[model samples]
Target: MDDPLAWLDDTAQARQAAGLRRVLAPRDVVEPLVDLASNDYLGLARDARVIEGAVVATRTWGAGSTGSRLVTGTTRLHAELEEALAAFVGTAGALVFSSGYTANLGAVTALSGRGAVVVSDVAAHASLVDAARLSRARVVVARCSAPDEVDRHLAAAPETRRLVVTDGVDSVDGGLAPLAALHAVCRARGAVLLVDDAHGLGVRGPGGAGLVAEAGLAGEPDVVTTATLSKSLGSQGGVVLGSAAVIAHLVDAARAFIFDTGLAPGSVGAALTALGVLRDEPERVAALHRAAAAVAASARSAAPELGVADPTAAMVPVVLGEPDLAVAARDACAAAGLRAGCFRPPSVPEGTSRLRLTARADLSADDLALVDRVLGEVLPAVLGRTGVSAG
Candidate 1:
């Protein structure tokens, strides 16, 4: 007789053979190394002010949210964050969720259903992909090479309600989507545009208002936006911004929002504090952009054969064809006193494994110098290519 879990071994063995196995390697709290893997773009995760905000909230409220938002989890802090997020993003209203992943689910599913059509970009994040699959709508994936593919898909879909989903800045190569053009297509086709601005908020646009605001699409009746507080905000929650009507609909109909527990008081307070910090220090956004450009330039210099381009946001991908080479590159970075992210199959495509480096506004000259040295030493040998130089 076969064991009930016999398939697990087969899957594990297949993954190991393909070099797609993953393992956790947690870092020390007080390590003497520079971090280029995390999404803390503003470096406010450890800010004293943000920490105090969390501490005060936990002391006053409880550690957990206690219940769902419709129940006892709706605190004054949550209300405050919602209002501030709406105002900053130039939307009519906002709703807070336990996490960005759930927020995307709530937005995509609630906005589309049976007899509806959902169009998604080829390079959308995994959360968005999962959301589209669960939405129960007719899904159409737009081709990445063709700019007019999404518009054509929207035009060809039946007269049912259409929802177009895309990322403001793609999480993989850090390339920016043509939001203004897409918005025009949506407007013409009587479809709504939903942008996941997780990578764009607090890094792109003026004063970090995000790509929607940058394109003058914020507060538009046909546009909806979702973002995470965990990235640039240095907090731990997600938000959805749209018209008042859309907000009301999600609160009433979204299963993800209705069933999920509310965001904790500490996370709400921390996000509120971080938003305040962003408002007060807009210069940090500029610094972050400069750093992203610097890192991308360095990557291109180190491996011109890779054809790396300047990133539109904080993510810089150093493409290595095979998974083993990508892992080796990451290990080399760690040995050189740096922390870089390793992206393998599933996170990226099968053949395009890469080292994903994120930029923080607080990186110093020494940090960049270290990056140059590490890449110069690792890229040439691991990649086995010429024209490799350190920045």
Candidate 2:
């Protein structure tokens, strides 16, 4: 008992030595900086309309959702959001959760069990991996799919009841999963394909329907999709979309849904409004893709050896090869009044760290130029490349 708490100090010291200690500093308001770190791809987070909707809902419904959804939490706002979300993503039904993480937890655990096997990509999001862990299913890590790797995994595990789980877009590298091919593999094996479209909703597919829709798998009986409203939708919450029977099963069986409080009324209202915005302004999705591609191209031109992948959506990761340098580059961008994300060690599976930049629809050509300038100046120093000059 006397020494039980001493290990905490030792662990903290170890993290500090490795430069991996994390801390929180809450911002009071927007700082005078160009932000590339945020996941607000549609730039609607602070939009007047979205904010107004939230305000109206708060006034009408009171602050919280009140209690668990099964009790007194369900409201008309929540119902409306679910209906709109299901229709938007081309699903027969949808169920909302407190966050995208919880949505993944619910979908994965509910759909599969000890008798099932979850074939997941090596690079799937942390939430999905955690869901697989909690599922009590045999999880097989498949090599990140090209167009054929998924089929290979399915073939190898032919006798098992399988569920193929993959990110619609790889979060760190911004590469897309081959959903159409993966869906075909699942179909051939009589398995279910679950695509987590957290980064793809309101950014990819027709009318911002998401990646599953883009691959023509949205209405397929063997496919399911999950997404975050906090990203391109500019709201707060998550949803699982699939066949009516699947959603009905989750409503009764998913522990995250049964135990967690319903999404706040304000978030439901904001999400509903954002969906309407997407319906009327489909061009915003195109703008986001264009911005991401432009950023990737600019970074490649500045550092020909950086190996910037052409983004399939709004995220772009500029590889830096080492962890300490990635953090240094991120700090330099912050110092230059441009904020970008740094990914290292556990956050990235490949052991190569990177600067994860998210392109927003509101970021202008001038903003992109500033990003290029900051990185060109900072990256060489961070990467320890002596003679390279800033562009």
Highest TM-score model number: 1
True lDDT of residue 320, candidate 1:
85
Model 1: per-residue Cα lDDT over 212-269, one tens digit each: 8998999999999999999999999899999999999999988999999999999998
Candidate 2, residue 212: how far the Cα is off, in Å: 0.6
lDDT agreement with native, every candidate: 0.90, 0.86
Query: Using Cα atoms with residue i matched to residue i, what is each candidate's TM-score against the true structure?
Result: 0.97, 0.95
Residue range with the least summed lDDT across 10 consecutive positions in model 2: 382-391
Please give the TM-score that candidate 1 achieves against the real structure: 0.97
Poorly placed runs, candidate 2 (over 4 Å)? 144-148, 156-160, 385-391
C-alpha lDDT (0 to 100) for residue 353 of candidate 2:
77
